[model samples]
Target chain A: MRATGDTWPHMAGAAAQPVRRATVATLPAVKMLRRALVALSLAGTIAGLLRMRGKGGVPPQEGGWREVGVPPQ
Target chain B: MTTPIVGLAGCGVTGSRVLHHLAAHQVRVAVYDPSPALARNTRVVRLESAADLMACDLVVLCGPAPHAPLTEMLVADATPVVSVGDDLDDMQALLALQPLAERHGVAAVVGAGMAPGLSGLLARYLAAQLHTLDELHVAVHGTAGPQCARQHHAALGDAALGWHDGEWIQPPGGSGRDLVWFPEPIGAHDCYRAALPDPLLLQRGFPTAQRISARVSATRRDRLTARLPMLTPPHAAGDLGSVRVEARGAGPHGERVSVIAGVAGPTAELAAVVCAATVGQLLRHPVAPGVHALGDEALAGLDLLHHATQLGVRVQEFTGVARATSW
Candidate 1:
């Protein structure tokens, strides 16, 4: 299928590589660090969402009559 | 070749995206917004009022229903206008302008955004391949953030209209509220009836279509938040969305066509591309003056599906299903 340029972010090409077998040597400490990092990232995302509370009540206009234009710049 | 100067009425989410695509295509753009400060920020030339936008080749309207007066003024001036906003509201506004558009001999393209826009056009495209269309279903699954989340809630909160047995009726659940399987990753999700204008417009455009329905689904969190507006939850769906249009009809033997349009970025960008492509087509080929929808005369010359595919809108078509499932 033909894909347009960078306009579609999800269409980005993945690195070409051969599949590799997982090693048996597992590092418990490293795995714990990874889990901690994921938890931290999740917390950060939740905080960001909570910070986005709307101002009390719907705005008088709701951008209905207002211009919702974005500047080209 | 001289660049065609196009006028833009709104610069909001979808409007701004339209401007971005138009600028990339080297189209001269003039913007008209009532707020002077909003106008001053744009790189395009700012006009004093909506009437001033009439000086351009075409006008792309991104304003609200309350802006119908401005649209009335545009059609009265014989300016071709394309609307990329609310499906139901825009349809009403276009109906009111039909007489003026006919008198002025200019065309108006309504419901040119993602769901109502591409959904209706896709239905028409598939219907053309069928000998007798029994039903058409349009479903939208979006993975968006707070901004779109609020709108989603509002849409579900409102009564949705659907076409069944050759009549318009409110579906028990506004959205279908049934399990609809979209493409992979989006997989199967619960959808509810939405007040999208596609069902109504599709029925009008394809009178033989006995059943027409449109529904929408969001991520788990967004879906829950839509039902409970008080909970401003984080986005669970990431940033991907898809619109699936399926038509069940007879072509020789019974068959069906299913099209899934996948968009990677914000839906507004895809919507902007649709509007920009429409504007480009209108500039190259002026349609007969009158009121029209996405699948109407104004966009007759445009191979909308082809243009959409070229703009990174992933389109997949599947045909030849069992007769029982065709209905």
Candidate 2:
């Protein structure tokens, strides 16, 4: 695989060992956080759907054509 | 110079839209379709057979795939061709016509539709903002027509081809889940790897890019039932769809940066606009006589996109805003 120098700028040479160790140590925490986010999003979606059921039903939004080009910065 | 007579094959959902766009532009078109339900359009001259399309200056194929035979016939006859085919195998077959197109001195553009077509063009547009572009990730949501819906269902079961580093990798279909954010109304969608032609076509254009992958947005139900036959017939025309392209590379300042951009609309209409824009580009400024993809350096991505915009396709970019700290 081609090395992503821009992505992993600090992961090079002997000085990178400590940074690599730190990254490895946080890997599990990062995974856990990601899973938690997914679960939360799923829960929010279900809640929204249930709320919609209490009302009539989901309303259809008609898509309209928008002017082309990038929005002014 | 007189305007070229363009031939259109297939009058299906997407093809019909292409005809409408071409006619709106006042382009003379000859159509070849066997369907008896084809509505009479004064702008189009109906033809009896696909062979009759060969007489036109250019032929655009929006038909169902296995387009190889018709594409071959057209290119071999020195008639330039543009195809909106998104099937992986069919796109490969079309790309294989490079030699034949070169031999006959006719240009043929393959996969000139929504995902592969607009997606590749968006990638090229983003790459221009970077110093050394290395990664391209494309995600598509929704389908255009019944044929497109069927292709999307089947693609989830076929192996996906991706370019990594310097070689190609075949990953199992429906793998590598990603949460991609598209321009709104079509917000964030859960995407997964699929047998799409975007990677192959984009690689042909940005050959130096280190990694390229393509995905399609899917729900859990969609993924679970992908291997099984469709439980229900696809809709004649699906809801609005969108294509998101993310390009990552070293920015002008040598820092890691990613640019995300997309186009959202009815998929069929987007595809038609792309096809029409490509047709206009080919007619006005002809490329070399060979098979090419929209992302190829020879084609100006910005110009094509500008033309598409004029045809009612909106291009959106993700300009992330700073989060409020106390909120």
Worst 10 residues of 2 chain A by lDDT: A58-67
Task: Estimate the TM-score of every prediction.
Answer: 0.71, 0.80
DockQ value of candidate 2 = 0.06
The prediction achieving the highest TM-score against the true structure is: 2
* Predicted candidate 2 versus true structure: per-residue lDDT over B172-283, tens digit per residue: 8889988776777787688999999999999989988999999999888888988998878988877789998888889778988877788888889999899999998788
Residue B81 in model 1: lDDT = 83
Clashes of 2: 0
Q: Score the docking of each candidate (DockQ).
A: 0.01, 0.06
The lDDT values for all models are 0.67, 0.85
Highest DockQ: which candidate?
2
lDDT of 1 by residue, B212-311 (tens): 8888874555445555564655363325666677787776756544333333335676667778877887888777777777765346467775676566
